[model samples]
Every structure is written in C-alpha cells, then in structure tokens.
Target: MQLGLSNKDQKKVLTAFYSLGEVCGTIWDNIV
Candidate 1:
C-alpha cells in the first residue's frame, strides 16, 4: 500500500528515519 506522499513529505519522512537511526546508534554505542 502506498500513501502517495509528495516529495516534500517524503523528504521529511526520510529525515525523521535517519534521525531515529542516529539516536539508536548512539544508544547502542553507549551500551557496547
């Protein structure tokens, strides 16, 4: 299923995903 988001919305989604990934990575580093 596709939401059919516009380019601007897609960019926002990608940015949020990357931010989440960075936060997880930081936590993992602290644990390891």
Candidate 2:
C-alpha cells in the first residue's frame, strides 16, 4: 500500500520518528 508521499515528506516522517524515539528513550531512562 502506497500513500504516494514525496521524498521530502518521507524524510520528514523519518526525522519525526527518530525524534520520538529519542524522547521515549530519555523518559525510559528516567523511569529506570
């Protein structure tokens, strides 16, 4: 299934996901 996103859009999505993962990791560290 394709949503027909452009390359720029895909890059933005990836960067957002990376930032989200970093935030989650920091929170996890604080909890542990």
* Candidate number achieving the greatest lDDT relative to the actual structure: 1
The prediction achieving the highest TM-score against the true structure is: 2
TM-score list, all predictions: 0.86, 0.87
Cα lDDT of model 2 by residue, 1-32, tens digit: 45798989988988999999999999999999
Report backbone clashes per prediction: 0, 0
True lDDT of residue 6, candidate 2: 91
Model 2 scores a C-alpha lDDT of 0.93
| Residue 30 lDDT, candidate 1, scale 0-100 | 100
TM-score for candidate 2, residues paired by index: 0.87
Q: Write the per-residue lDDT of candidate 1 for residues 1-32, one digit (tens) a residue.
A: 35799889988999999999999999999999
Residue 18 of model 1: what lDDT? 100
Once model 2 is optimally superposed onto the true structure by TM-score, how far is the C-alpha of residue 32 displaced, in angstroms?
0.7
